[model samples]
Target: MDVKRIVLLISLALVSYLMVLQWNQDYHSPAPSVATSAPAPSVTTASSNAVEDERLHLGEAPTPAAQAASPQALIQVTTDVLDLRINPRGGDITYAALLQHKQRANTPDQPFVLLQQDNQRTYIVQSALEGLANRGRIQFQASQSQYQLQEGQDSLQLDLAATIDGIPVVKRFVFQRDSYEVKVSYLLDNTSAQALETRFIGLIKRDNSVDPSQGEALGMSAFLGAAFSSEENHYEKLEFDELRERRYLSEVQGGWVAMIQHYFVSAWIPDAQQTNLYSTRTDNQGRNIIGFKGAAQRIEAGQQAEISANLYLGPKIQSRLEAAAPYLELTVDFGWLWFIAQPLFWLLDLLHDFLGNWGWAIIVLTLLIKLAFFQLSATAYRSMANMRKVGPKLQQLKEQYGDDRQKMSQAMMELYRKEKINPMGGCLPILVQMPVFIALYWMLMESVELRHAPFMLWIDDLSMKDPYFVLPILMGASMFVQQLLNPTPPDPMQAKIMKMLPIIFTFFFLWFPSGLVLYWVVNNVLSIAQQWVITRQIEQQGTS
Candidate 1:
């Protein structure tokens, strides 16, 4: 086989391997059997019963009360970007829908619900003060059932108060405009003529239900699980199966636990100064529970104490998440190429800010990448041009040594040495750049900012595949053009296979996100332009 055919086969093999690897990573074996139990009560509470303490020590099974759908009033709170409902039963955030992000590109009126508690599923953020009898079971009274951020208001605060054993406890939720993080504070007033000992337990309860968006794509499913961070392990994923078998127990000064799904997340970030116990369990309703319990604090008589934590409920915006907590940005996963993907996303974002268009920004970013590797591509193109220049001579040598494999190989090597050509030089440059291209592909696919962004006519929603296969067709055309400008294989079979690659790639790209296809098309066009210039220069020099 000729050099071009060999390169084509290698490229196809590489792409196939990557596709299989990605498929395995995204959709592994089904999770282990679902374990149903009630949410375990806290052991640090002073009023815990003997059975509760033994269960906590031996790893408790979920209680039956967790599955009871008892009726309770929900308080609605609306901010600039978020619409939320807090359950007064335990001050749990039961429902949260992002007002700015819609459920689909075509549906502007419907918002994306990130957290909710319904008959089929339950996902909520909950926190309660431990040590009091039935703290999480107690009822709290709110000032109002509904609260909205007024016009021109920068922030809004809602308070829920409950008197437990004469200790007045107030749960405050502070929502800010243009932000997804809610500041949750638990204030305890000790007015019973004695010091009160208590600790705060914050957790997220989510059922083992899949997101509707997970089935939207043909290739890979989005990651859905429980993840945590600590000083020892920067980030760790705990699936429902793992929680079922055993609890993930850890003690860290500052860490967070989160329930992450496609495009969005909800985490409980406790105070950084105090030590907290992070763990996970399964509820009786088959819901997964991941959370942290803060260390105990004493409140003197007539004195007040406040413990606060931040609840993040929104899309996985990397910059904002990083500001919220360390390594939190990692929720926007890019697989193993995070180092390269992160910087690529930064550049893409920078370009988007300057160009104000995601599609155009992708094209510009591709151009910049090509320019950065101009020298390497020029060398590869020069090598290909030389091979094309000597194509006739190589053909003559093959015919001269017909039916003699050893002689043909020797003659081709002799010819290559005489012509000062490196048979492998062209492939080296492409191999060196494959990682970056793959990284960029993943970065674009995982970016939430491009979810519903539109480019121009006929190309809306950069995150989804093209409604029509126009971009993929243009990409294939560009690829064919690029092949035409490069050296052709002497072997008939090899040449035919190389010619079929564009067709195969077009079909493969049809399912890819339009933003990624746009990048590939732009890169191919740029490569063709550069190769044309270099090939012309080489041909002229050879004639001279």
Candidate 2:
């Protein structure tokens, strides 16, 4: 491929990826739930003779003005310990509540005095779904931090005991309380050792009262394709075209590794990982709803089945994640990523480390990549130029073959055979570059570092659209000019339609991020220049 051809290809691919990036942001998932349906207890018992509204306030006191309030109908759960931040926009929990998490002053999603709940709450939200993230939280039956260690060593004994039914169930969640991954060593030691029989089960339940219609901006939808349609533009309620979702699970040494990115929550699970405290939702309208209940099995006395797993909770970064295991990075599938997608994410990670900025890193990497592929691109341009020069000959052949499509194909093949031109020679470089393009798409999409990241003028945020529409306009202009430079078969009707491609492409890219447009614009400019030079060189060679 020649430099010009590479530039053109890069431009086109960049434009396509930009569309992908935009799609990821469209469906915004809210944060994880707080507790089951409970709100934090209040410090003061506000009794204004408030309409016998005493039931209106359940916790210790009422919701403080400075604190983000939980829904009025807060019900205290007696399950697992969880802390959550109540977000204002959708009345959803923006952050998760963890073990011993009594009160939080401030969090990533919200900054305010978090509402506190004690034992149980009488106040319930419109539905339990929207109130899952806050105060009157639940507690896991078994806890590791509560476990006492041996005589004089930090090496703690796996001490766990709980009652599932009339039968006493004892098992240790062998993991650090704060960590996402752990090993759950289950020992159904029939203390009686009298061959007691009972069913072993692992289950998490959601509040049945949750109302899905109470929330908005559910999850990413139709990001896989539908954006190209003329009918897709009018719909705002649907997922914006660039949203992405990925779930990666793998078998590792002792247990398994998982990489998960849902709308509101992102998690990475590592091998030998276990957790007794897990939060789940059962609302019909929640985006990316998940529920798992392991099959019930009868346990033999004094026997054990070791279950291990590694879990990660956060953004999709390659280095931080792949360090967890192999192929875990695939959770950030850009768009039909192939072999090189993982490598591309790694490269982006390397660039991010050096440059300390993902947006700039992507730009630098793209530039270097363009330079590296200079030779292939140059050849592609040269080939295209030759074809452009032979336009008259190919046209003549078409006319000569007239109504005989088979003869035209044969004549074209004969001409290529005589000229030593491989009919598919130009496709190789393009095909080879597809993975890199796909990887880059996810690189931008999954990189939380690029979220709200700003570039130079007219592009305040690499993750968002160009506020002035200047970049998109330039993008369309570039596409149009590049299309002009590339030679097409002689057909007046086809040429006219091709001319409309820029306008069409421009409309799709209007809401796309500026960094993507910049890449396309640069690539297009380079392609135009390369095509011009190659065309000139071919003409000179022909004359000689």
Candidate 3:
């Protein structure tokens, strides 16, 4: 009936929603296996040939020692946006760093490493041929180890050559300037007397290491495992622990499999024209592998066949991901309410483009959201205003019905009925807006554009918490002011707890992303302005 009850209901609703999310993360069942019109080969069958099985098992040969044997063995390729290392042993991308994204806010020189193969952790992209034969250890030889994109160069190409069963195979990686997508093509010049039946396999293998890209403590857990796009589902998350239970197998056309962390992702997108077999399994060393095997291509004697797929290894930029493959932008993972979140982000980005500052954009977005919900908020404020106007009557009833619980409730209900007030009107409107608020929270937390994005003075990175807790303090102050505008609860205990809501929320928000906190602060300020005006208007009319 009063501000305290509304606040309590909102708190309970938020907590219940978060608990549901956590529950889904822990115990959510996996989707049923998706099958295409044509049957794709199984993992074992894909590598069924004895010769292919020996060489195709990924993460096996190119031991850390072998990969670390010499710098010459690792080919370094640098583009405008990417710095990557290719191991010549199996033509796998051993290391990939985003040249444009910093690892930490304070360290501008250190780039964020997305994939690495060192003693500390093993997360790398690998490619293997599934039907090749006659191989001791396929060692690729590069023309030159270090390749850099020149100032005028728009693209760079690095080719690693190896011979398998007298066939010359060239693993070519093409990198474009200012782009994170790499075209990995395996060119097989089959000069043997027999036809070669081989499938191109692309795998992303990584250990269960904590995501280094995760920001501040006590934040919502970002998905830290594998995901894929299928014809049936646009995006499906496959947690690392889920892979341990049973391998994920799906056959689909025009799909991609990726390893996603907080702000970064690496996906292998096969050709969209053919059916691909996608699977996930833990290797011998307890590393999770999610990859796809393209349809088998038959290369006749003395014929040349080129099998290629696109590798996206960089920050999860929605535009870039969408350009790389269909439904790849869903990797942004804005939760279940993406339909709402998507438009919210679009508007936010548009505001950013106009304002040229993320902080200002957030404030303006909050104002716009408030305006859109003006009618709903007005209904709530009017209800609270009416309740405040009858404060003395409620107090009188409490005093007259002291220590008599039934009489007190009856008096309150009768008074509400006479006043034509709905006790639930204030809470229901807010409960309706809870989903949008949560969606915005996820959008802000998961947006790579906001990472290290500066606002104005004192707020250097919107993705991180406020360094000095200034915004959170201001947020608490705004909430306190809002409480002042609304009628206090008649119950003593309820009033006490309601008074503490601001402080409690302030502490919880101390660790949240500054961008999200900014939104809340602005929303609260706007609500205070609106409620103050309505309460004054209602009071003046009542007095008159």
- Assess each prediction's global lDDT (C-alpha) against the native: 0.80, 0.42, 0.82
Say what the RMSD of model 3 is.
5.3
Q: Tens-digit lDDT track for model 3 on 1-544?
A: 4453766666666755664543444345244232222122233222223223322354344445664535566889999999898878778788999989999888999999999988767899988777552243368899888999999999999988888768899989999989999999999998999898988889898887777887553246788889989778889987876776656677778799999999999999999998788887765566777888888899999999899999999999898999999999999999889898999999999999899998899999999999999999999999999988888999999999998878888889899999998877777788778888888888887899999999989899998889999998999999999989888889888889779888877876776778888999999999999999999999999989
List, in order, the clash count of every candidate structure. Answer: 6, 65, 0
lDDT of predicted model 2? 0.42
Question: What lDDT is reached at residue 48 by model 3?
Answer: 28
lDDT tens per residue, model 2, 1-544 = 1333455456666656555444443444333333322332221212233212212111222242322344432222111223333222212223343332212212334321112222221111110111111322211243322233233442333434443323344333333333323233334444344344322122111222222211121111212111110111211111211111221111112222221322111232323222111112222222222211121234455554333233343334554445654544444445456355556666767887898765677677777677777777777777667667667887898788887767877887788677666544455665666566556655555454454556666565665566787877887898787766666745555567568768977776666656666666666777678778877887898899
At residue 496, candidate 2 shows an lDDT of 74
Per-candidate Cα RMSD to the true structure, in Å, reads 4.3, 14.3, 5.3
Which parts of model 3 have CA positions greater than 4 angstroms off?
1-7, 13-56, 59-69, 133-137
> In candidate 1, which residue ranges exceed 4 Å CA deviation?
1-10, 18-72, 133-136, 213-215, 491-493
Q: Which ten residues in a row have the lowest lDDT in candidate 1?
A: 50-59
> Model 2 RMSD to the real structure?
14.3
How far residue 472's Cα lies from its native spot in candidate 1, in Å, is 0.6
Measured on C-alpha atoms, candidate 3 has an lDDT of: 0.82
Error of 1 at 419 (Å): 1.2
Highest TM-score: which candidate? 3
The sequence of per-residue lDDT tens digits that candidate 1 reaches over residues 423-449 is: 877787988898898898778877889
Error of 2 at 23 (Å): 8.1
